[model samples]
Target: MKVYLSVDMEGVTGLVDAEDVQPRGRDYERGRVLMTEDANAAVRGAYDAGATAVLVNDAHGPMRNLLPDLLDPRATLIKGRPKPMGMIEGLTREYDAALCIGYHARAGVLGVLSHSFMGHEIEDIWLDDQVTGEIGLFHATAHAYGVPVALLTGDDTACAEMTAWDPSVATVPVKYAKDRFAAQLVPVPEAQAAIRTTTHQALANLPALTADRARTRRLAVRWQNASVTAHLTAIPGVLRQDDRTVTVEADMPHLYRLFNLFLRVATAVTTNPPYC
Candidate 1:
């Protein structure tokens, strides 16, 4: 069987600082190494559970966080950003199952270094009225692709958040957060072991994927501040529905395009004084 893995840094064991997840920050290399180890553990688990191949997508920051040479030889890695599918880029109907590694909880999730995707600008995101994180959004997309998300790795709060999506997927809590920027980390080996076990269980109990074959859906964006809301209303039909929110009607393919456009606009707003 083939499996796809989406990996991030904030949810990796022992990492408590945002700097650790970005290339420009101190200790980022160290964080990448830890993130790689966690990915390897999942590779090991999937292989043990009879998977013949696995693909890993580096979904954080530049999306190039994982070291190509250090990753498991049995799996391929998809890096860089602006992918049409984002976290689930390389995934397809041919894949058997999927996994999400280093997944922090949703934005405003206390005790975890939590923020929704594009944390600096996105205040909150909702799908059909229910607030969700990247994990949930990606999970829905994965379901649409006919791939079940088999495992999720992160701090305890991240695991708790996953329950809002797929409660059956195995969860590996590699650390316990004290707050958004700090946590009590488990030793690397312990984290790896837990991830391995969860990976195995996830594949072992992997159920048929749930995909929304429906062609149309709504994705609403809620920015942290009004300025951000003003920035997006420029898109036709994307108007301020509320003080801090805007709603867009999208089919699956259009949804992907809108999401990227939104990401770009958000990134532009926060561009530093050098650009300003």
Candidate 2:
């Protein structure tokens, strides 16, 4: 079976602040190592569960955080930006299962390094009228391709977010959030072990899983600035709901790609860092 892993950085083990995940931060080098190790744990687990092929997408800032040289050679890696699909760039209906690694809670939540796709620029997002962050958006997109999200690894709150979205999916919490930038962390060894074990179990039971059928996906974005909305409305089919909110309805993957473009536009117009 083929497995797809979308790995983010904020929810990796022991990472509790922006300095840990941002590329220029002092500890960013160390953070990359931790991120790769966590990913490696999942990769190893996928192999343990009888996966014939695995694809790992570096789904964090710049989409190039995971070190290719350090990654498990058994799995291929998807890195870099301008990817149309963003986090789930390499995903398709052919994969047996998908896993989200090192994700965090949505914006307005009190989890470590918590924010939606674009830091503070995106105030809120809705998929089919349900509030969503990166986790839900990616999950729905994967489901659209006939792939079930079998396992997720993140902090306690991120695990809860996934659980709220789908109770059957397994989760491994690498840390417990004390605040947005603070958390009671699991030791690196322990967190990696848990991720591996859970991933193995989740995929081992993949036969019992079924993907949600594709549907018309509706997306609503509430930006932090009205200027962002002004640029968004210029896109065909994008409807302005208010001064700072815009809504669009499209099928899966297209809606996901359009949202990526929205972030690109927001990035062009805003100067705010991804975190406060």
Candidate 3:
């Protein structure tokens, strides 16, 4: 069996501050080590569960956060950006299951370092009117290729959110969020152990964990500022729903591409200097 692992930074063991996730932060190195170890644990678990191959995708800022040299030798790493598929890149029908590591809750929700895709640029994302986060978005993308999300590891809120979506999905909570940047953490060793155990169990039950396909997919993105909507409206098939929201009707592949484009454009506009 083959497994795909999408790993992010914020929800890794003991990470409760945004600074820890950035490359320039004082604790950034420590954060990377923790992220790598957690991922290694998951990779180890996948192998233990009879997985013949595993691909680990670094799905955080810049998409190059994971240290390739430090990663488990058994799994191949997918790094860098500009890929058509963001988190679930390289995913296809050949994979038996997908594992989401170090994911947080949706924007405006309580989770350790929680934010949807872009922190301040996107306020919320809705799929068929359901409030969806990274987990929902990436899970849908994986599902499109017939890969089931068997295991997820993150903070308490992220685990709760995933459980609500699919009760059978195995989840390991590395921390309990007091707020966005504050959390009651699980020790690194414990978190890693939990992730390994849960991953093994999840893969063991892969047949039952496969997700059902959505009948229809309509993605609605609500930006934090109205200015971001101006850029998105220019995309073909993207409709301006309101000053701060845009809606797109497409399947998972197309929708994922549009979302990637949306993030690039929105990030560019939001970071540029204003001209009066």
Candidate 4:
């Protein structure tokens, strides 16, 4: 079986606050290793579920979180920013399934390390008029490509949040968020075990969704910070809603690419400086 994994840093084990997730931050290196280890656990699980090949995308900021030498040698890594699919680079209809590793919920979801792309610029997202998060948007894109999101690993809120969008997608709760930036730790080994178990369950019940269309879909974002939203909604198809949320209509099945572009524009506001 072929599987595609999208890996992010925030929900990885042993991480907290921006210091551990930001590139110039003091603890970012240690957080990166933790992120890589969690990804390997998912890799091990995918193999157990008969995944013959897995491609992992470094989905975090700058997209260079994984240590190449320490990654699971059995899989290939797609690293760097400005890539075609962004977080889910290698995804295609040819793949049997997809997995999201170390993911978190959108901003204000109480998930550990939770924040939408470009932080506050993304207040919320909607697909087909239903409120959604990055996971929902990603899953929709994967579905458009004829792939099922078999497994997901993240904080309890992340797991709970996904349950609403995809009840059947296997989920492993590696941490319980006490609040936005804090979580109760689950031993590293324990979290790994939960991830493996849930992955097996996910494989057993893959959703029967068709994936033979010409990558057409819509993704709209609502930004809490109006200063940023004003600019994004100014794009041709983008419509500004109220003062906080900006709606962008995109039909590209390659949503990640569009997502990458939005990140830059949303952060262009002078008041909300980037890297602060």
All candidates: TM-score: 0.92, 0.97, 0.95, 0.90
1-276: candidate 4 lDDT, tens digit per residue: 888999988778777678889888899988888888888888888888888898999998899989999999998999997776777788888888899998889776767767776665466777767877778878888887889898888888888877887887888888889877788989988888777777766776777778745655566677666676667666677676678765555555745576666777764564452222
True-structure RMSD, every candidate? 2.6, 1.2, 2.9, 2.4
Model 3, total clashes: 0
Candidate 4 — which residues are off by over 4 angstroms? 212-217, 250-256, 270-276
Residue-level error in angstroms, candidate 1, position 98: 1.1
Q: Residue 186 error for model 2, in Å? A: 0.7
Show where candidate 3 strays beyond 4 Å: 208-215, 272-276
lDDT of model 1, residue 69? 90
- What's model 1's overall lDDT? 0.82
lDDT of each: 0.82, 0.92, 0.86, 0.79
Comparing 3 with 4 on lDDT, the higher-scoring candidate is 3
Which is the winner by TM-score between candidate 2 and candidate 4?
Answer: 2
Q: Is 1 or 2 the stronger prediction by lDDT?
A: 2
Candidate 3 lDDT over 52-144, as tens digits, reads 999999988888889889999999999999787788778877889999999989888878777888876678899989999898998787777
Model 2 over residues 136-236: C-alpha lDDT tens digits? 99888887777889999999999999999999899999999999889998999999999999999999886444545446778999998999999999999
Q: How many residue pairs clash in each candidate?
A: 1, 0, 0, 1
Candidate 1, residue 87: lDDT: 70
